[model samples]
Target: MRADGSGSGTLSRLEIDSLKAGVRIEDLAARYVPSLRRVGERWVGLCPFHDDTRPSFNVWPDSQSWYCFGACRRGGDVVDLLREAEGVDFRRALELLGGPPAGATAGRGWQSPLPVAVPRQSEAEPELTCEDRAILNAASEIYYQSLMTNAAMRRALQARGISLGTAQTYHLGYATGRRLARYLAWRHLDLERARCLGLLHDRLSGEDGANGDTSGDDVWEHLSQRLVVPVMRGWETVYLIGRATREAQRPKYLGLALPKEPLTGRGRPRRSQGIIVVEGPFDLLLLHEWGYWRQFELLALLGTQFKRRWLAHVGPDDRLLVATDQDDAGEAAAAELMAHFPGQAVRLRWPEEYKDVGDLAQAPDGHKIWARALSDA
Candidate 1:
């Protein structure tokens, strides 16, 4: 079927098979179930379709299918899962999975409107208001101060090979979860505005007078106990993302209610050798800690999906070093990026033992390996 739901020419069987083969069920499932984890040969996570207390949803990588053995009691392939989860028709789901092959409908009268690429952030994101900017800037300062006072957070940074200086330079902060509301109150800032920006969540019961009173323990910080990383643009905190410092934190990462953009380093490089693209913020952080910023500008996609908006950072002369994770999703992203940039994009392959650059950070010779990879690139 056509992506626009028109009753025109149907997609060829080859196109359908190619979509199923190209996109992994587990990777697509993870978007709905962030808590999904591997179990033996399959993946298991809490069923997102129902009130699943225990993990009953299972995904088989080999078969590329998922089944929820919970109250929902549903199972299907990647397309089926996407259709059910997103309430989209088969044609829409196919469109979302990078659409049909380019010339699948060459002889047909209608042309496919879908682009042969992954979805990207909108070209223009809504600009943050002055009040919004004030709230984010204040929250950034509050989290930075909290990180400074917290000895454990400092040790955590050290363990990750991130120096205190690097942390400071990047404005890395820790969320105590309790201080932000009070800090905003003290500074005469708008608590509701902060809450709207996803920095806070309403925790007060109806009995506590729901009159938007956020100062009196009525709100909880959204990024509590997580390491906060603010994406800044010339002194303005344009975005905020938090990483789980502890293992028990489900989903592992959280961010504000804003369009996902690449987490970039402050200031331009001294000499633009190339742009290193990574999957996670921590991977970018470790590279900065190792002093790669001297020659190369770092960018973290925050995930495998590359947003077209990030193309602004790539110059015609600057090469793109794709250092995504060594997993299926990462490999797919790397391939897509290379296909997009052609000869200008190079995949930086590390040892198979390491899943990503962040995993390499734990190794004793990680810095050496990273330097060698860049040297080779």
Candidate 2:
């Protein structure tokens, strides 16, 4: 609950621990540990932590923990359980499970202390919240995991000339939610937050319509049908863009909206004075995979829908490299963006045959291609 008494919910660590301790591991596991089966009071699931056809994963209801008695033995408390099940970190687990542990801050100052060093909201952009990152990370992880497991994404990558090993190395993932509303509901995410972040539609009827932007639902409605690429700022999954796999789908690509809630800058910085802007996530991943990321940091508009102020945030001293696709759309988008940076923007040109940085990376003369792209700028 917030101090203003407006917020309706809270996240308590004790409550989470109690939920773990009281809830039957079998029942709890059944709810979230996908691909798991319940037997008597114990739950047996395919160990996500290990490779196993046999069910060796066991959960202890009383202990509020799970253990995998397999080659890749792994298990721990409910926190660990959620971490593995959701593929997220501790902070996110805390968010999903609800507030911190009871009495953990019992002795803390009662008086409302000095306001923490909050992020100053940009007048141009509404303040984003810490919860926004939590939702983004969770969604990004789910989409990424889907890509790793989806057969179509792998085939699509191959068709694009990206090798299987390279795809995994880049942590490529896909989104295939048969229904966006159901996915968001399962995660306990508020519909407004999803709508605000451009994850769900506002006019879907029922509870969804109350949220807003019925049109945005069209973006995620085809997720299970698209190739998802996560855009990470440092370790935090801040933004994502989805590309449709089906040839007939209209508006071939979609991006998550810029978060309107206040954003918390807790993790390490993910930008640099030198930014290499790419049109697609695969190209960004390819650059990072090949150690080219360090020479020049990578950033993406996720597409051309970026606000003009987004470019304004880039410091005047920073170097901006436009590495859009070699095709017509890429060239046009690059031309528009180049006009924004003016003196700071440098265009990365390549052979007419190469369509993107990923293509250049895979070329027989990859190093030379990169050199040429860098030099031609």
Best by TM-score: 1
Go through the candidates in order and give the clash count of each.
1, 20
Candidate 2 residue lDDT tens string, 1-377? 21111223432333333333433445556665587865433456667766767666666553345766455445676667777877977645544443333323322323221112233344554545787777777777676667677777788877666666755654456766544556666888775676567665322112212112234443334244667665555667766667767654433555555541111122223455377788766676666655565466666655433456655567888888888887755765676676778898888888888888777867788768877778777
Q: Tens digit of lDDT per residue, candidate 1, span 243-308?
A: 978765534676776666678976567778888999899999988887788878889998765667
lDDT of each: 0.76, 0.58
TM-score of each: 0.69, 0.50
Prediction RMSDs, each to the true structure: 10.2, 20.6
Alpha-carbon runs more than 4 Å astray in model 2 = 1-123, 158-171, 179-183, 202-222, 257-274, 305-318, 326-344, 353-355, 358-367
